[model samples]
Target: MMFENTLAFARKLDAEDPLKNYREQFYIPQQNGKEVIYFCGNSLGLQPKSVRKLVEEELEKWQNLAVEGHFTGDNPWFTYHKQFKEPVARLVGALPHEVIVMNNLTTNLHLMLVSFYQPSGKRIKIITEKGAFPSDQYALESQVRYHGHNPDEVIIELAPREGECTLRTEDIISTIEQHSQELALVMMGGLNYYTGQVFDMQAITDAGHKAGAYVGFDLAHAAGNIMLDLHAWQVDFAVWCTYKYLNSSPGGVAGAFIHEKHAANTQLPRFAGWWGHREEERFQMKKGFIPIYGADGWQLANAPILLMAAHKAALAIFDEVGMEAVSRKSKKLTGYLEYMLKSNPVMEKRIQIITPENPAERGSQLSLLVKEGGKQLFEAISAAGVIADWREPNAIRVAPAPLYNSFEEVFRFHEILSGHLR
Candidate 1:
């Protein structure tokens, strides 16, 4: 696995990559008529080439069938979301009945919180990571307030130890234990959006359960980027967006997973809709709510057919490649990115990587904390055709998605960055 900071070495790796052909399956964006080295999959994944046709087919169905599309198309709009269960379940390592494709990420998070974030009497605190994605922060804070509790008192945010950029698993577990008496929910991002640190979900879930708390994860950054076994981890619930890493279109339909143990509990509180009613009893339009027996019970509305079509197109690629193969290539691709960045003398002095160095503790992203000229450097790379993302203040996040990004592109980015640093 020796890596050399040379174009030849990068090309060699690209030639050897089993997933190399996947690059052609995506429509890479162009700058001045040339393809940009796209490393922003952590933000928005590149569109799959098949997306247009998949979406068009749905359009054609609507055009031809109109209202009849609901029950008559090849994939009936009535149950279009059902087709996603198996692929998404496989992607996140859950039982087919345990997962469902539904609303956008934050909405689903709120729905999950309604059912799982019950706070009774003195046990009413929620534990989450500090500097979480703003949507998560707002969701947790608002949910606390809705229950008539003060956020400062009811929410405990675990911070990284001073001088470290990522949360240590020990620190997280200890914090749960520290507030065990009052902890009602333990929720965190499976991967930190800024630092790209992958939390130990199984450990966190076990610790939460032992402390008598419901455990959930916001897998917005982790779902398609890493291997997740939500069921085996005994996670009570989880939610993720499809756009990033999953490569569905912008604002694609999001997904949720509820462990079978929780899914069968019909008495669980939720904000339900008719789509979540038992299929056989749904058309009766009775006054009482009869919930579906699994994760489908959490659905708030019928499927968004077009969004589901886009999601299906991207997931088909994941199903074909399999997460195991994707994980293997991801480790090597991201490792090469890290190696090339470190090997550049100018970069070594000008930037610091905030992401975890261990592959197991991270996914495909590397968050570089630029020491000087951060904005200018980011702009320079952009002008040079490297489409990486810049967060506020100083960090530049680059993710080499295994499905479409290539090793040579990573090398070219380093070359562009090195030239800019000079």
Candidate 2:
């Protein structure tokens, strides 16, 4: 499909977009009485209009029902997390019992590591991307130390070849095979946050299993932005935050997935908590910890009702629209952004799209590496009301979220950016 770099053409696409009406459901940021061209959903998604009412309902329950809110309210706090099991499972392609809405991303990562990052006898090393999100790096390092091993020796960080922006699938597979004997775990971000590259998770999981290692992904960026199949791919475990593309509020409750094979193993080691105890025996309050079946077994505490309410609101949209439609619009929306950027002769010469061009290898984001004036260019865009993200060293990342962002907005961004170039 040919794309034209004009406002009329952009509006034409928007007019035909099936997902255009969904944009009205979100509150786009305002700048000087006008809506800014928001492309920062990858960092923090816009709030859903339904969030206020849902959150207030929880607050009302707390205010009126008091202690009885746990057992008597419309949405009982005791079973709030259970409501997300089906929708969240559908979002990530997992069995209903295999998913849980829980603590923040890093916390869930630590909890998963406690169970899956077992280093025994000769198998001690963990394989991960070199520039994984800082939290993941810290978590892996601390986990290795907790196991009485040196991180430098027990962790293998994969890097791209010279001058390459992303890791190749072959290189990743080869590295896993090369250290197959000692590799105990293979943990990586499902999508690179900085470069916007989507890794081949299925292939990676297969390779890890072949090498006698447990494989998992930190799906902070990939969860809502791309399609995933944790169960079908046989991923041992995975975790992600809802504040990004999921459009839950800031630092909202995150999600986790454990394969049925791992989740059903109630004896699996974990940092046991009372909430994770079996429901039938929970009130009995026995001495021994008998974990509830599936991913809920890893829960360290009870639900944060307010946060989960926000999450419930967000997931309803995903449930209504479905990830299949979201991903389909994402390809066309992001592709058009790339085309519009490249259409600018000045931008073509001065900026580089470091993200993979293939639609399958990326999501909504396109990381622009400005050949010169990187910071200044980012500042210029920001001043002009473009809500994009800036990474250190040299990159401006923009993600046109399919759920809310429109083609007209992407075209407007191009116009603003081209003006700055001129």
Candidate 3:
């Protein structure tokens, strides 16, 4: 679709958007008594207007029911997390039993590694992308150390081909095949946090399996931003946080997915907890740890009701519109953002987009690399009521979220940025 750089054109697209009403569901942040142009959903999403009421209802249940709230509320606290299964399953394209809302992303990653990253004999190596989110890098390094192996020898970091900003799928597949003999696990972010590049998960999963390895993903940036098919892709496992594109409150409950193939395997090693024990016999308080049959078996504790409430509020919006619709709007929103940035004569000459140019290779985010005065440009935009993200040493990341961001805001951001370009 050809885009025009005029306010009228942006407003026209906004008026015609099928999901345009969704913007009213969220509470956009205000700066100096005005709504700021928010393009930071890749870092943190705007809060849904319904969150307060959902959370208040939970508070009321606790106030009225006390200890009985565990089993007596509208959504019983005892089985609170179960309600998320269907909606989240739909989002990730998995069976209801394959997904579960649980601890934060990194904790779930460690739990997944316990079950899937068993390195033995000649198969003692793990492959991941270079410069992954810091938590992922730390998790891999520590996991290797915990097994008494040197990270330098046991972990392979795949880098971009010399001059490229993003990794090539061919390079990733070949890396998996190259270490096939010793590869025990292949893990990567579904959408890279820094470059905003969306990796080919299906291809990576197939290559990993053929290479005799377990595969998983950190979908922090991919979960609500892109349409995923964890089950169809045969991903061994995956984890994601809810605060970014999912629009749950900060530090909201995270989620996990374990393929059905592994979910029912009771003998799989895990750090067990009482909540994961078979529900029917849970109250019997038996000495043995009899596991539940699926992803729920991986739970380490009972649900955090308030956080889950916030998650529920946000997911209801996703369920209403459906991922296919959300993804369609997302492509157009980011495309407009990209087009406007490129059309700015000053910006086009002074900056470069580090994100993959193809829409299929990214979601809503576009990472810009300024040739000079990167920090100054970031500050100038911020002062002008544009809320974008800046990474140290150069890139400025902007994501025009489909649920709440408007095409007019995208055009306005371009106008603000153009005025700041050196």
Candidate 3 lDDT over residue span 1-422, tens digit each:
99999999999999999999999999988999999999999999999999999999999998889889999848899988888889999999999999999999999999999999999999999999999999899998998999899999899999999889999999999999999999999999999999999999999999999999999999999999999999999999999999999999998999999999997798888999999999999999999898898899998899989999999999999999999999999999999999998877788888999999999999999999988889988999999999999997799999999999999999999989998774
Q: Candidate 3, which segments miss by more than 4 Å at Cα?
A: none
lDDT of 1 by residue, 1-422 (tens): 78988888888998999999988899989999999999999999989999999999999999999999998958888888888888889999999999999999999999999999999988999999999999999999999999999999999998989999999999999999998998999999999999999999999999999999999999999989999999999999999999999999899999999999986788899998999989888889988777898899998788888888889889999999999999999999999999998887878899999999999999999999999889999998898999999998899999999988888998888888989888
- What overall lDDT goes with each candidate model? 0.93, 0.94, 0.94
- Cα-based RMSD of the predictions, in order? 0.8, 0.8, 0.8
lDDT of 2 by residue, 183-256 (tens): 99999999999999999999999999999999999999999999998999999999999999999999999999
The better candidate by lDDT, 1 or 2, is 2
TM-score of 1: 0.99
Each model's total of backbone clashes: 0, 0, 0
Q: In model 2, where do residues sit more than 4 Å from their true spots?
A: none
